[model samples]
Target: MEGDGWRDIKVVRNPYFSLRIVPTVVPMRYLELAQLYQRLEKTTLKTLKTRLVADFLKKVPNDLLEIIPYLILGDVFPEWDERELGVGEKLLIRAVSMATGVDAKEIENSVKETGDLGESVALAIKKRKQRSFFSQPLTIKRVYDTLVKVAEISGEGSQDKKLKYLANLFMDAEPIEAKYLARTILGIMRTGVAEGILRDAIAEAFHVKVELVERAYMLTSDFGFVTKVAKLEGNEGLAKVTIQVGKPIKPMLAQQAASIKDALLEMGGEAEFEIKYDGARVQVHKDGDRIIVYSRRLENVTRSIPEVVERLKRAIKAEKAIVEGELVAVGEDGRPLPFQYVLRRFRRKYNIEEMIEKIPLELNLFDVLYVGGKALIDEPFIERRKTLEGIIEADGWIKVAENLITKSVEEAESFYRKALGMGHEGLMAKRLDSVYEPGNRGKKWLKIKPTMENLDLVIIGAEWGEGRRAHVFGSFILGAYDPHTGEFVEVGKVGSGFTDEDLIEFTKMLKRLITKEEGKRVWFEPKVVIEVTYQEIQKSPKYRSGFALRFPRYVALRDDKGPEDADTIERIAQLYELQERMKGKKIA
Candidate 1:
């Protein structure tokens, strides 16, 4: 794992086109790896990492540092510096050379000419190999860590150095290892395996209940922690772990209540209903002097909303606290702006000052999970509400979410209409006595959109799309989960609502996970879940699942969800039933 091992791997993997250079004095394993590449016609990052690790552990007597670079950066030479190359650029060159048997120099020249490394790689690979060798397995945690490290690095470095590192890592990987590495780099894995697959794997591996894994994931958003514990303690340690606050619990989804009154009815006739705002979900943590803001995906977004961070520091009256709220952007007139407008502000890297001035945001506070060094997840909703209200002083920029204690469905309905009139989404009903459940979406809370219904679809198959989508499989065929067999049955295909930028980004991402081809189509491992919005749901014999969504559009990718948590067929049936109920009630 030393630096030199990485350098050596980078050299071998960095060839422009196919080269028949024999190693002067390399280990047998290294030679074996190269021969395997020659036989397989291609190698991936995941496979390389696994082989390198296994080889290292097996005392294979190879230069692991040289191998680490090959596995991590795709560089196999001793002279390359990873600091000089961009991860994407390195991957592009390596992919091209591997697929085409073309000289790495030719690919690099093409990349330099077009300044489109991704495109060059794609073309090279396409011309070199008609079919992919294997699919890589990628997890979100690994990618997140890698990106964080990438972001941490500083200074000007040549793209070639970076490529060398990435190329070397991938060239030395094994199939399964490559699968994980590729998935991580691409940022999505559609293995058709539910989150339950990993959960079950972890549970069995550690000997802990599935519930504990769920709880831990909810609390920390760290799957690696569970895996590590399972590796070390052997299940008993995992079972003994308790869920605590300040550890970051998952945000609960607001339950849909057609009217404020209906929400109260769901809460047993008298309940607390909060006005669901049209804004971004934000989780704020204050560790004494340090304040951090995270999105629902647990991404560190403190830099994106420095204003909110400043506001929280002033308004939150606690020594140490972790709270959740909705971040709403407002116009100069002081009214809340559209959610899309708020999102645009976050997406921008340039002219941030101008954007912030043009689209100021306010934080509408909701749940409080920690205060004064104590966790509040175990507290009842009512108690937590009181604690939150007591700790935060509402200001022009930060305010408590509007709520009402109601007894009848009619009253709840009235509030719902008022919120809609204010251009809000809808209402969120919570069980007054419920505890904060991390990583679980249940009846304790539900989300009711203002207009069209939302479907929590499980992604089944994705095709490598055209134009900008040539790299990642852009259009996804989604399905409803079958509870009995624990499978995803296709319901519809969504190809709209994605920005061109997103299309390009996703294409590069999806390409790495492709496992097989069917005629002109490529298949992937389905593990990602996305929330889709549609104009209507229709019964269909054409789709594999016997259903379809009209005007289906991308809403957001769900990182917090597990495949088991995807919308089930029974839930689809419930939506249909609810539609019918609404029809009958309306006619009456």
Candidate 2:
């Protein structure tokens, strides 16, 4: 046992390797969680996923219940917490190599082969050359706390320190645990377990209704805390977790609609049509003088746009309120600029004043979730919109979104055209009687945007589809030809608009063209062409092309076209310029 890297705790001076591993306080072993992750990954059934999680949560001690949900969701903190591991794939490979005494190049090759960093790390840990004697079995609390410490590390020598901590954890983790650990840290734990499934699990574990759990999650934006309260105090405790003024509520999302006529029919004819500005989705929370701004992903972005903060503080009449809106960047002509301009402001950290000068933003307030001491989320949208309008005096910087209450499709269509002519993306149709359902894409709201131009792009890569399309390719990574460089540059990924027959045909076609495989991504020879229709072209560094298509959907396979004949980057630039020129122009 001495030479085999196993240590007896009695003989070891520091048994847990600098970790405050309190044996008595340990509630659930990480091995158990890892086992659950395996089971979840093996199946795609929602019911099975719910049963597995519910059964696991039922066995969790109340004291450790809070972190369980977060861990299962592949995060140590909630989305609104503003903290992240910040460790990239390179750092992870280095950490895994350091722990397992494997060559870094070998680890890289393994990742390339599997297309999954977690799976590669897991395999490395299983075949490690050396291990520490005092390696302790990981607990849920221990793993969560250690990961938080890793994320919180910053400044000089933080990378080395993070690597050390991660290596230590890897030493203690079993192969399966290491697999899930890497996935969790990388924020790619695709175990087919969604938050909706987790909500159901929490409800099942506590013997409460799923609606209660979802309501609690919507108001709090924290499923972990929701699970704990439900486990301890049941429904009564859950009911207490209501909307807070300064805390961001998950903004209610809308489903896409084919047209205004269909949207009106879906909402019983009578509906409220509001201009859907092509900008950032913002949720503004105000308590006294403090105003917090959150993005659509629930990331705290208060510091990015101070102008919006000042405007909210000055305009909001109530002492405490929560409002939702679209933040658009406008040019000197007082016309809305492209969404990309606003995104630049959103991403700007330093040189805020310069960015503000470069791009002035206007907040088009729409829905109010809280006012004074009352929670308006459960209230009707009509009432909420009224409260929003009543609480804020319309100003240049902040104003309620231009809305018209209509029962006719023709009226809605006219309004939508006017909005589009005014440079907005489209219109949002809302049921007047529907309540504000935070974090849900319920039938209460429908988004209507007219069809835009389609691009025939080359298939550069594809990912293995999940659930029902598990055997076929579900999503595709498309690229445009860079005429200058003679290279294909990625623009966006599309997973929608494919028929079952298309999926089968495309899967077979792409599989045959696979140049290489890595994780879920399969690099193709770029010989295939596909037609894609998108809402708008925006400047984004997220893709290699330095541009991305918003809501890009597949139109059809361009068998008539080849990769060499695909759209060029020049065309994308021209389209973007055309869109910009159309803005602030009179639509005669």
TM-score of each: 0.70, 0.71
> Per-residue lDDT tens digits of candidate 2, residues 368-425?
8888899887788898888888999777889999999988778888899999899888
Model 2: residues with Cα > 4 Å off, grouped in runs: 1-26, 254-272, 405-417, 429-432, 439-588
lDDT of 1 at 20: 52
Error of 2 at 23 (Å): 12
Show model 1 residue runs off by greater than 4 Å: 1-86, 89-102, 105-151, 158-161, 167-184, 188-194, 231-236, 239-247, 447-452, 456-476, 480-488, 494-532, 539-546, 551-570
Instruction: Write one digit per residue (lDDT tens) for candidate 1, span 393-499.
Output: 99988988999777766777788788888878887788889888875556777555555458777666676667755655668778787755556788888888778
Best by lDDT: 2
- What's the C-alpha lDDT at position 479 in model 1? 76
Clashing pairs counted in every model: 79, 4
